[model samples]
Target: MMANTNGYLVGSNLERVLKAGHFAVTAELGPPQSAEGDVIRKKAGLLRGYCDAVNLTDNQTAIVRLSSIAAGAILVQEGLEPIIQMTCRDRNRLAIQSDLLGAAALGIRNLLCLTGDHQTFGNHPSAKNVFDIDSLQMVQMVTAMRDERTFQCGDSFKGPEPRFFVGAAAAPFADPVDFRPLRLAKKAKAGANFIQTQLVYDIPAFEKFMAKVRALGVHKQTYILAGVGPLKSPAMAKYMKSNVPGILVPDELIERMELAGAPWAGKSKEELTKDDKKARSAAWQAEGIQICIELINKLHQIEGVSGVHIMAIEWEDAVRPIVEGAGLSPRPVVTESPPLAAALG
Candidate 1:
């Protein structure tokens, strides 16, 4: 099989675009908590043509939502490329491998592997955890299936195997921050072709993390897309800082949100009509978008950085403006091809 410039035997348009040296763009969309396909389609429509690919999150925050693979298949049917996220929180290796085969069968070509948030964070706090394999092992298992044509048990497949452009996540701002880069290096060595980091707000800290990554030469081995998003409100910022693990929201950003909402900050619920509160909230969101755009511009210049992954996080409508604002609109046209398994067959 002929490999693309990025050196993967099987590559999607995303891989080809990145391999051809375009600044790749990806976005995330959480499937609706309900089983309504229309909701998923609606959100997916908002992202189409705005990004190279859209990520269908896998039970993000451990909340029950439409299955990622199922949602991805819907997006595929809508003529959009979907990166089906798979988390190990709910499934063992058996289910993981089974779903990978099914996802590829449905024409889903990209995947983002993650060790999902603990169930305690979800609506189902009493649910049992089934982390049969960590995210690193998940990467290795999928790589084996794709590149080695073998199952996790080392059993060779008698037929076609799933071909995926595998990805993993990195948290640059996580505790024991100094060790973060090394964790990334381990994932790269384990066969992760690309990485999308956790939400990044503190650039200086991210730059330091990238410095260590470059020093180790892992950047050369895998493409790194810094994660970024728009903060909806000052309360949202505070909640994330206090509740979400590994997220770093600078106090200056919180102050900016407060200032944006200052007009109505002093007003009581009775004094401020719904419109007044809506207008003030919009201000905070607007400032948040601006900050996100600035971060994208800065991250582009960082060495070893390949692209930005915009995670609007329920703010799907904001994606178009953010991408256009950052001058990333009119995404490059890249040719797509059949999966490696089918093409080779």
Candidate 2:
């Protein structure tokens, strides 16, 4: 792995930009359910100039989607940097290591290791759970592959090993919030160079989490990118709050969405026209974007936060507006080598 002048190992522009002391911006790309390279290319194009890197989720929420690594290869072809997400839900240790080798062979340099959601919540609820190695072990294994050129069983590699900018996820709002920071510390000790946290709606709670993180000194060991996004409507907000584990959407945000949709408040469900509903929905989405912008502005002021991860979900078009509104437009240029192909060779 090549180290920049500052001695930070940076394989992609995302790492370069962050290590260069810039407030980095990253977004998520949800690969379509079908095997369509055009869909990946289109989404990549939308995020190309706006973000430092884009994270391609691996079967996010346990829903079956196009493969993250395949979609990442498509993004690389589109001249975009992709952070490929690897979850331990569907694969065992052998498959995981094999995929990592394949991804590196394809020129992928950034990886986000995850302990996937339980299969019971996904479309394949009947499928067996494969906790072959938890995410902590996954992080340690990848670190060993990159730094030691050895497999988890202590076997040496015959050829060049994969060099990745490793990352993991954290949920600051999860139950037993006090344990969240300690959990992050464990991942960092296990070799997570960076972390992208779950969606952060309650800033006060997030501040508390960061305080504990700083106290534990985990912030010094890893770069943290707080997650932010725009909710499409009041229903979307409520759905996420009630159904999504570890996500806390404050009532104030939901109330704000209600106010935005109040223009059509008195209309009966059957009486409301499609156009009226569209306008109301647009109002709520606009408010959502505003809230996201505010959050980004505040997140930058937090001492340990290195950047923001804007997860627009399927609403890719909303990313540009949020980024620009947050004054993160005109992203910095990091003169790094091309991703995957150049990096691997």
Provide C-alpha RMSD values for all models, in order: 3.7, 3.9
Please report how far candidate 2 places residue 114 from its true position, in Å. 0.3
lDDT of 1 by residue, 1-345 (tens): 322424445567778767767788899999998989999889988998999889999999989999999999999899888989999999999999998999989998898999999999899999999999999999999988988889999999887889898999999988888899999999999999889999988888889899999999998888899999988999999999888788989899889889999989899889999899889978988998988998899998899888999999889998998899899998888665433432210
Off by over 4 Å in 2: 1-10, 336-345
lDDT of 2: 0.88
- Choose the strongest candidate by TM-score: 2
Computed on alpha carbons, the lDDT of every model, listed in order, comes to 0.88, 0.88
Candidate 2, residues 143-185: lDDT per residue as tens digits?
9998888999999988888878899999999988788999999
**TM-score of decoy 1:** 0.94
Give the lDDT of residue 111 in candidate 1: 88
After best superposition, candidate 1 residue 40: deviation in angstroms? 1.0
